[model samples]
Target: MQQIEFQLEHEFVELNQLLKLVGLCDSGGAGKALVATGEVCVDGTQELRKTAKIRAGQRVRMGDVEIQVGSST
Candidate 1:
């Protein structure tokens, strides 16, 4: 599996924002659509909430990309 690591500026990152930050979605709107369609999985569970509160150390997967969320500091 391809592993991609990224940091959330704040303690948490919204599902849409995380998608954009990790280059999964081109824009917020696109991310929203993806999340709404139940294409996002958090820790291997399907997540349908567009604004799901993702915290540090969490893993987010959409399609073929997987990102590991961490703190910037």
Candidate 2:
């Protein structure tokens, strides 16, 4: 699996934006569409919320990609 580290600049980031920020998709809109396909997972469970609040210390996975969210500080 591919691992990606994302440092949060705020308390949290929207799931779709996070995917975009990490280069998973072209834009947030595309991210939302990807999430709607039920391919995204949060902490090992399927996550369908396109705008779900993703906080630090959380893990997001889609296919072979896994994004590990961390605190900015």
Candidate 3:
């Protein structure tokens, strides 16, 4: 699996935005669709909320990519 560390400038980022920020999906709409189809997971659990608040220390996985959210600093 490909592991990516995402640096957060704020306390949290929305799920769809995260996907786009990490280049997981081409667009926000695509990210939302991926989440709605149960293709996204938050910390090992299938996450369907497109706008779910993703904070630092959280792990998001979709297909073969795993993104680890971390502080910007």
Best-performing candidate as measured by lDDT: 2
Model 1 over residues 1-73: C-alpha lDDT tens digits? 6689988778788889888878877998998999998878999999998989999888998777888888887
- Per-residue lDDT, model 2, residue 37, is 100
RMSD of 1: 1.1
Question: Among these predicted structures, which one has the highest TM-score?
Answer: 2
The collision pairs in model 2 are none
Residues forming the 10-long window of minimal summed lDDT in candidate 1: 1-10
| Superposition error at 59 for model 1 (Å) | 0.4
Q: Which parts of model 3 are misplaced by more than 4 Å?
A: none
Give the per-residue lDDT of model 3 (tens digit) for 1-73: 9999999999999999999999988999988998999989999999999999999999999999999999985
Ranking by TM-score: 2, 3, 1
List pairs with backbone clashes in candidate 1: none
Candidate order by lDDT, decreasing, is 2, 3, 1
Better of 1 and 3 by lDDT: 3
TM-score of each: 0.89, 0.98, 0.95
